[model samples]
Target: MTLEPDLRDDLLAAVPSLRAFAISLSGHVDRADDLVQDTLLRALSNLHRFERGTNLNAWLFTILRNLFHSQYRKRRREVEDPDGSYASRLTVQPEQGARLDFEDFRTALSTLPHDQREALLLIGASGFSYEEAAVICGCAVGTIKSRVNRARSRLSSILKVDATEAIGSDPVIRAALHTAR
Candidate 1:
């Protein structure tokens, strides 16, 4: 069903705040603009889920936050090596050792069971607390902790590196491994 005129107006009025929040979360104007657009589209599509007389702003913000987190999780696994420069940098065996190590870590991460991987990503890469991860994953806090621990151990074994040894210079990779403990 189409939104009523007043509801449509309210949604349009929320755009500025949504864009600002997106910018603060993304730290890039272009990405923030895209995020705001996506948020509005999602809100429009899900208007039936919105309750009348409730805080429309809160609902929109929640949608934006969820979209950001979902995108963040997907983006963390991607390498932005548009040209050959990044791969060439890794060719220097000594100076760019971390680059190679990051590749290996990424491969090992993909081999993890979905549950363990999800827990690790939420807690480590996304910087969510155990309680928050538990809520997101619909599991007990202890279960999330267990999954993270198991995932870390499995990754360490697969990469044949000491659990405490620093693997890659990539901040997200380092955060995932370091915070898994």
Candidate 2:
């Protein structure tokens, strides 16, 4: 399929940002890159259906996000890797407390409702304004804000971190927890 030069250029320009968004959504670099590749292929195949003047970035993002969710649902039934088998094979240093904290945070994050998690990530991690998130989520700005608030509150509860208390003494982690509260 031949894409117009301008359209091809625009799509190429969006790749890095799309991969970053995918990583934020998937939390796995390899999976994120694969998702990005799949998204691009789908976009190219559906190029004829795209409206010339529409927001291409938003369209691409919507496709990538939906793909992630669909894949996530399918992965739910898959078996996990054997516990220490995967971890023990990796060389670890004695001073890797930060990794443990990250694991805890990731666990807590995965517990949040999908809406809240997406809203929180779009605003907090992806640097999207509430309005932009609203547009992307196909909802009101107030709805996006509410989701982010609820997500943060739920995470704080799940992690058992008080607004004034710190997690792992890491300022970045502490600020994230505090801000959510």
Clash counts for all predictions: 0, 0
Q: List the residue pairs that clash in candidate 1.
A: none
Cα RMSD to native, each candidate? 17.4, 21.6
The 10 consecutive residues of candidate 2 with the worst lDDT sum are: 172-181
Model 2 agreement with the true structure over 1-181: per-residue lDDT tens digits: 7778999999999999999999999999999999999999999888888899999999999999999999999999665676767666777545467667768888998888899888888887777888999999999999998998888788888878766355665544554455733
Tens digits of per-residue lDDT for model 1, 27-138: 9999999999999999888888999999999999999999999999999997789887877777433747777877887899999999999999998799999999999999
lDDT of the candidates, in the order given? 0.88, 0.84
**Whose TM-score is greatest here?**
1
